[model samples]
Target: MQRRGFLKLGVGAAVVIGVAGAGVALIKPGLVDGKLGPGARDVMRAAAQAVLYDLLPPPGAARDAALALQLDRLDAFIASLPAPTRKELSDALGLLATAAGRFALVGLSRPWAEATVYEVHEALNAMRVSTSNTRQQIYHALRDLNVVAFFNSPDNWRSVGYPGPVQIP
Candidate 1:
């Protein structure tokens, strides 16, 4: 083959390999089959409990059921997001799933599921007040998801004194 043609082929091959590697990196284990894996789900549950502790019903079957419903809703909402957004959330959740990531991001060396409510609260507060924009973004995203999932439910309307939609004439 001509030297110029060989160079062009080599460049094309390198580009293809780079693109393939990037695609593989995007498919992390935290998102299994395009949904949150068990670890990620657990992290999200802990986050919801911590961030919405005051707003949630008292500890009992009722609270458990409410959290389950909200988690389901959040899962659905996440599934409906665009691919890039979903991947971003999955990546964030993946980080939260690991002890190393927890310590790095929240300054806690324990898994999120094992962290006390107070500990989780402190971690979340740290994220909220951190100088790093990524930390703030993670805090906001989790907080917003928790609040939106909880308050949007009909069961929670009474807590905020928001009556149901108006009746038609």
Candidate 2:
């Protein structure tokens, strides 16, 4: 097939996504019953490795614990959002949790759990520079959410030299 224009690209992508979604629906990944699930957690864990590369502890048990705390904070933060926002985010996360979405939307050929930080970083960079606004939004959302969640961990406070909130009372 010859190189096509943006409109054709969008249409083709939509078609591919439609077919992929049909298959993904059968496996039931990510959110279920309006709550974040294991699939979403996997997606965020891999993404956090990339987005918080500098802040994260060097790879070890410490890093794993930190990532786990980050996921906890992320769930809490997302849970606090309005219902509609939660639904939208859940849908987005669900899509990214799928193999097709990971490859098509994120350009990551490997499973999220198997993807190295470098691969995840490169995939995120691709999304950041993409012409599609939706892709850009996903990039920003993942990065921002990771930042918010990781920094929220009190254990991580020392990484940025935050000494906790000053008491006013």
Best by TM-score: 2
C-alpha displacement of 97 in model 2, angstroms? 1.3
Candidate 2 per-residue lDDT, tens place, 29-54, comes to: 46566556877888899999999889
Candidate 1 accuracy as lDDT: 0.78
User: Which candidate gets the maximum lDDT versus the true structure?
Assistant: 2
lDDT, candidate 2, at 69: 80
lDDT of 1 by residue, 20-83 (tens): 5345435544567776688878877888899889878898898788778878878777777899
Deviation in Å, model 1, residue 123 alpha carbon = 0.8
Segments in model 1 whose C-alpha atoms lie over 4 Å from true places: 1-28, 167-169
Superposition-based RMSD of candidate 2 using all C-alpha atoms, in angstroms: 3.0
Backbone clashes under 3 angstroms, per model: 0, 0
Residue 21 deviation, candidate 1, in Å? 16
